[model samples]
Target: MQDNGPSLVCAPPAADARSGIVLGEDALTVADAARFAREPGDVPIAIGEDAALRMDASVAARDRLILMRRPIYGVTTGFGDSARFHLSPEKTTELQRNLIKYHLNGTGPSAPVDVVRAAMLVRANCLARGYSGIRRGVVELIVDCLRHGITPVIPERGSVGASGDLVPLCYLADLLMGSGTARVDGEPVPAAVALRSRGLDPVAFEAKEGLALINGTSFMSGFGVLAVHDAEGLCAVADLGTALAAEALMGNRSHFEPVIHRQKPHPGQVRSAARVRALVRGSDLCLDTPQVLEANPDVDGLGVIPLGRPIQDRYSVRCAPHVNGVLADTLDWVRRWLDIEINSTNDNPLFDFATGRVHNGGNFYGGHVGQAMDSLKLAVASVGDLLDRQLAMLVDTKFNHGLPPNLVRRVDPGDPAAGLHHGFKGMQIAASALAAEALKLTNPATAFSRSTEAHNQDKVSMGTIAARDARSVVELVTEIAAIHLLAGCQAADLRGAHLLGLGTRTGYEVIRDHVPFVDHDRRLDEDLGVVVGLIRSGALVAALRPHWDADV
Candidate 1:
């Protein structure tokens, strides 16, 4: 079959718009990223796109070096700890091939299929820039792999976040050389068979092609892309959850009053507060009187004095915007960093062969991505923690004001427990466990580094770990938010209140549509799965987009 065209992968707009350096466009909004998942053949790869000219210039300089007698490090000699070794013209090819083979030492479980695909796509794009002294044929081969779904089985471990994502990328290089393993039609096959099945030969590594392939932060960038994409979803979910919690608690909507956010003037805080206000708009529960005062007519309840339940709610309910606001700020910072990384030429020995200067530098270091991922993970964890606390409040009779214990089906018709039983006991436990895992993963991986390879890689970025952790935290937060959604929907259903914020009511209805109220306890995993699927599929995000867009 002819190679399919560029797929509509949904990467963020900022990350996808630029070119040259790999990683442009937000990973979340990139349409058809799976099209670039391996390497496509028909897609036109260029070096001098309007957005990537600087990188193109850098690569052109390297090509100029091959015409000169100057001994560029990887172009003419050797690489890495092997930079001192010079290769003869006949042996240069062998040197390049060996470089890829030696680096294919990654271990541990295979990375997610999407991440592996993204890594291959990024590597090919970097090569297409032409700065790496790689043959255009090599770039085409990589693209062809993407088009054909020939994803190399890259291991998740072994990258120290320095000298690029060498270890995992080595596996990718090996597959291209017909020496490693690849997934053909979703089945693991020998590299040689996989290449042969596509009627292709092993890619012959040229001068710096191996180094170029293995010597970038594609592993970290892949995770960064995936995490940032998912984080956007988590942020939206957080907004939805906060709205639900606010309505359920019957807290002051004045806290989200636009004027309150305007005074603070922080963009994220302002956005978050505004989102909360929008979600709770038209909420009858938000306007409902406290049950304690509503139930008692004569006990110190003068007709002149309006009866109210508790004077105040717990901090989790009252201070939701303050908690989720931090996450909004963190997401902004991550988005900025990801945008820069995606558009940056983060390769080593940056080929300025044009200036007769091959500057072997630490441009490939993933410290920026590392710190950003760590910060994002922590922020996400905090959101998860907040959601967990909110869910707890919903289920606990002592905390819910008048709601049933566990938000369950009550036993007696007239009794507070009549129709409700513990609706979310198992879900609450699961949410708490997910939150705890998220919290444990929040320790900044950037700070926990061990100098490896005889201290040559003394300062490690641990950026891949950070990105993976952030992705994990995003998943955990999504689950927590789903639990909150379930609880909030149940509460709203039990109360029979008509008014709900436009966005929040939509979220509640979406949840109700997927997993009906737990009138009787059945299989909880099935319900949880439905929620997870909805969140991952961006159902909730789609539901709330109009309200958020209008408010913004």
Candidate 2:
């Protein structure tokens, strides 16, 4: 037999060459998960030195129970409705193996690689809490797969968010045991082959190891964390968009004044208003309603009082904070919930080594996650709907003040494409379509929850579905925001970018770097893609956030 040097499977993440996040050592934030989940290679993952010891204690506690012949769910007895069917001591391994094998019936397309990686990281973090009776070796197997850039082909569907994410996570169990499929550079390949290529062998499941592996809210919480991160960024960019729209429409700046929002003072609304003010600081484009009213006071019998511009912007421009703020507030609670869920010991029939007792409970139920994501879907779609409306007003000549129809720019009036040009017209329609789809998905997935796996598993939390739906809404809304941003940038070009504020001017330049000014009618789908990428990557928000450091 030829030697392949060291087995990548058993290599310690701590021993890896890069500085990175330590699971079980500290609380994992959404920011940490985002950095690692997107590119696992950039940030290495390591288990804390004490994490293995904790797993050892859990295993020992479980061993003492089995030695005494005491009954336990899924360990000494059958699962779900068959909890009454006790098995012989020798069948413990088979019980765990059957748990993984049967749930392999997960239906749906394989999840994206980033999602799979995030799920794996979250699951490992849960087991690291060391209440799941997982062996140190099984935890290492998961870490090894991540370190070697091998992600399982877990299905996106299945799992009722109770009894853990059993079906989808079963694929993870299969890869750990070397049976199912894994993605090798985004292409499907046999798990065994992938493992062997990395100079590793498939793990043999222990008594409660399979139950430990598949029993948690890893999939739901993992995807939830990512969605929440994007939603948060989108909130910031929405403020930036509001600033640009206010300038483009020559709308009233009084609408975003600190004194006005201070009266109502919802934390999100206050902060959003402050962010917009900071972004629009030193701008000459937006109107001051007080100045307009004072300068044009009626002199002859309450004459028409021609102030020229409208006294206030439309709701989409004026109430942007109110729309985006709801999601911002939603994230305030959602982040805390997800942090708890991911760091939780969600295992059923948990072993407490400190007290030498076994406690059975339903910690695997993801009710909090379901409600958070359901609310996230609603709040996020509202932002998209608002942006869609903003885009609507931007493209219409009647509402856009003095801007050309559809924001069409005729550099050479007689250059032949004069009336032929229809700039930003198609992008507006696409934004509307995206906003509609996003609104449709907001019909709470949790509201339609149904029973599954017999009457024993009644009242399941459809949190996984809700999380997936939230992710879809975020993606759709991101595209919608992208279109709004592109249109807002075009509006800036029409209204004179030189008149933009310090923050919006900086924002416009950054966008113009990626997408040039639309001079003529051309293929815009690619431009939309580029801008969408910028939004999701958080680069756009990063460029504009520093200017808001003091204000928000």
Candidate 3:
């Protein structure tokens, strides 16, 4: 069956040949995952010298345990409910094979190719930590799969976020053994065909290799990494969208003053204010509130003093820093946690070569990932609601400070009224609908944990579900931001975009390049697609990058 998830467009890894990442040595950052997702490539991935030695030592320990007939979990014994049923040494290899085959029951759609690739990278990183007692060949096989773009078609469901995403990860282990399906350059084919065409053969598993490969937090980590990276980009996009809307609304720039932010002393608020201030810097359209200009007579007659603007813009416009600042702060917290998670070994029964012992622990639990994702979804949904409000304000003349109703550009100036043209009328509705859906998904996924596996797998972390929800919220917000971006650009043009701030001007021009000013009532569906592509393609984010840096 064909896998229908979005195909990842391969981009080069952020690190070059000299600075490339080495498995089990260099740390993997969320940004690295983002770069790898965009451009999947064959970067150098080898077991580190020290890690390899440790791996050898670990394998020796496992062998000794097997010789002594030690009752090891998933090694010399059955799994889960059958843990008491011991396996003979001769049947260990067959037990490992059966472990993977029985868990090949993942339901639901396949994850996106980028997610699968990220999962592969994360899983390989964990194994390369020299704790899983796996052979170097197993690590090399995973690397080759990623290097060749052979993304296993793992289902989106069947993980309870405990015992480390076992069901979905089984598909990955199955693919390495050439028994499942994989996507070769986005085309689905039999895993055996994909592997053989690349001059590779299916791997034969040893006693504990299959369990080590299929157990751990790779799936959740992959989704969480992508969500965090996308959230970072979305926060920047929020700043850009709001900056343009501020220019269009002729909003008071005094609200973002450093002194006011200093009084509050929130790092995120300060950064957010500074970012917006930098974006609107050098713009003639940005006005000070009468109270602000009046209070400061030093520069009273300095700028193009606009008259009849409100004493204070609405909360959506004036309180943008507070909202987007919360987003910035949330990202800071999430990144801090993910940095540790993406690098740490999250498997069970970690073999300590130095101690010559196997340690069983709950490192496989995904509660940390779950908590981060749950909080992240709320932040993402809040931004979605913020953008939804901004989009609404841009479409209504009452709130838009004299921009045309629904932001309809006037073509025939003599027509006096362009009653037939209703611009962004339905677009605003779409934005609201998306925002509502995102908000509805904000219910904590961790609260719905279910017990399974004969009560052995009780209190499973629903971190995977939370991560998926965060990803969905990010996607929805990206759409809403696209609508607001298009409308903000149109409003900027109608209001004489020359008055826009430096960064806002660049953003406006970029939007105008792809989606022209909507002068008449026309279907904005295609325009939305163009703008969404620009946002998702990172053009909008890149355009706004300098402003944030300058502020910093």
Residues 1-552 of candidate 2 have per-residue lDDT tens digits of 111122211222432335676665436667777667887688877887666677788899888888888788889998889989988778899899899988988888878888888889989988986788888889988999988888899888888888879999899999988898887767788999999989878988877889888888899887898899889988888888888988898888888999999898889998999999999988888867787565555657875656565677789988888887888888899989887888788878888877778899999888889999999989999999988898888889889888888899945677777788899889888888999999999998888778777888789889999999999999999999888989999999888999999999988998999999899889998988998899888888889988999987
RMSD of each: 6.1, 5.6, 6.7
Judging by TM-score, tell me the better candidate of 2 and 3. Answer: 2
Best by lDDT: 2
The per-candidate count of clashes, in order, stands at: 49, 0, 3
Off by over 4 Å in 2: 1-19, 294-299, 302-307, 411-415
Ranking by TM-score: 2, 3, 1
Model 1 C-alpha lDDT per residue in residues 1-552, reported as the tens digit of each score: 111113312322332424422332223222334334333443333322321443345445666665575566776787765666665555666877888877777778888877887677666655544345556566667766766778889888888788878888888888888887899867899989988998888878866677887888877877777777777787778878878877777666666777767887777778887888888888777753344345446555444654455545577766676777788888787777775565455676666433546777787898988999999999889889988998988888777768777777656777864654556888899889999999999999999887877567788899888888887888888878877888888877766536677778888888888888788767778787798889887877898888878887
Give the winner by TM-score.
2
What's model 3's TM-score?
0.92
The alpha-carbon lDDT assigned to residue 103 of candidate 2 equals 90
User: Residue 117, candidate 2: how far off, in angstroms?
Assistant: 1.0
